[model samples]
Target: MRFLGSRGLIAAAALAGTLVTAPAAEAAPASCAVADAMVSAGNYWLEHGTNLAAPDWQNATFHVGNLATVRTTGVSNHKTLPWAKANGYLLQNDPKRPFFPDFEAAGEAYLDLYTYFHPDPPILADLRSRISAEVASVAQGHDDYWNYVDALNMAMPSFARIGLLDQDESILDTMQKLFHHAEKEIGLFDEATGLWYRDARYVGTGTFWARGNGWALAALTKVLQVLPASDPRRPEYLRVFTKMANTLRFTQRGDGFWNSDLLRPWHYGGPESSGTAMFTYGLAWGVNAGILDAARFRPVVDRGWKALSTKALRPDGRFGYVQPVGAAPGPAKPADTAAYGVGAFLLTGQQVANLTPGC
Candidate 1:
């Protein structure tokens, strides 16, 4: 996986000792087996590591991805889902302060679990109120509220999910408006490549930071999933997604991972599993959703899944090569795993499992 600097491989070996070797010879035979194993690795981390039940976005991201992993595999890790429900889906932030995107990210799991069951979930009460208020604020011309690209992953799906569940078109409408205002009006997207700048500063350099575009692509897939086909804004969402899907097509490394910076490969050049997993997740979802051509995206998904399993997934279940928490493109080592990185890995595995075999 072509990393950014001269020390990239040396750094990877130093930190992620797991990446230096392969799994046992008796590894699973089927692709689904690999996917299931990846899920198990994630469950192990959440269950045993310090990541479980944390209210912050880092842990929240993992839990949200945990939901997808369990839902797709039909195997719930008793530790995470029930714990989230028991805690009322909250973390370090108070419900009283709801506008922060990171605080609201946990609601993705809450709403998913709420929908998984039949009736209107009681757990939705607190989150619903906070999200509604936030959406209302944006509806009143707070279009640029999500100024950062990360906010898209942190909050977009919650709004779209709530809108779809309640049959409230206004909520979906306001959510789309806010996304366009931040991305398009703010000029975060590079029209030629279909990727996004990490923020306003990176826009000047037109750098396509991997995780930044990963957030945009993954969040776009989420928004497309919840928005009704009949909705007027659906086409615009698909258009944006197509551009991203096609752009990411050419930039992936030969080994299937992407560097920290998608465009400037030399910048912080190293295999970042988190960003690769997110792109894998988004691309697989696009193909599954029929928004992307299966013939075109299937190979990308296949190569990405290979890189993830071969290079990122350790035998002990520790997903590695995650970039530490940051707002922009930066260096990441193979051993540098984080909660959000595991989240992205699990989400990608979920979509990989959903893909029709031999596609």
Candidate 2:
């Protein structure tokens, strides 16, 4: 496999050595064979699929996303994070995928994916400036889609990590405004079933879209990660996060993945990777933060990792079963491949890595 950096290999090697001495609690479960599979799959993608020699940065977005997945999955080093950040300018400049509009969220996802390792100040500043401007302009209009809220929520952590809290207060305020819009206008809270509506137009009849809720769950988790306990909005964020988690936890399938239509399993035939990855990431983060019971949620994380590592990941590192890019939940097409799905998978993997000892 192509070496993104030495840290992941070194970490894995070190962990392997200590595995003999570590207590039972520290040893990965036999079921964690899924993690092994993910590592193998990710490495294959890095070595065979990525165009490391490509001159065009836009074309490298897939490679960059894959590398980020390796890092999050604890199979590669942190060096790829900086490489992706440096290449962000090129991604932003791509005429085909302009940085303006919702694509700004994609940039933020990359920034968040990289922040665990490479915390570059200048790049963070540039990202914050761009996000602030976009949020300011976009907040003025009315948006009914839940995914837009998810994207903006995904970006907030990148801003917080760089000490942009004070500078981005208006942005946070705008996010809060948007959350309320989702709540009141988008039918986020349904009275009949006591679940959030999938969208504004669909009332009680609409099931809670798994990816949409996943976006909300992830956004809430990301915001809470950096939001200080003293911040005025912290409590509200926590409440929303808890509510979403509770609602979704019961919807988890027996095999440990979520269906595309959260409440109606028959609508979409199988488990969805993007939404499942997001839930795993969110639930794991909640457990780590002491917001949820570790004992209760650890199994959820394990099951999610197992399902993702085994079912979605092919031996070649191509993540399958990912629902294609769309406005709402639908049947996953075989041809669908998405950068964001990989991003969500990596985010979940990163959380799992943190939980696993010596990884």
State the C-alpha lDDT per candidate: 0.74, 0.59
User: Mind giving the per-residue lDDT tens digits that candidate 1 earns over 1-359?
Assistant: 01112232233233223244432122122345645665666766865566455667787778767766655554556555676766766634654554877777778767655554323457677677877787788867777768788889888988887776676778878787888877789888778778888878877686778888888888888878766677788897788888998988999998899888887787887788888999999999998888889998999999999988878877778788888888877887767778888888877877787674521
Clashing pairs in 2: 188-196
Model 1, residue 357: C-alpha shift (Å): 3.3
TM-scores for the candidates: 0.86, 0.72
- Over 4 Å off in model 1, which ranges? 1-31, 91-98, 117-120, 356-359
Question: After aligning candidate 1 to the native by TM-score, how far in Å is the CA of 35 from where it should be?
Answer: 3.6
lDDT of 1 at 39: 66
C-alpha lDDT of residue 169 in model 2? 67
CA RMSD (A), model 2: 7.3
Candidate 2 whole-model C-alpha lDDT, 0 to 1 = 0.59
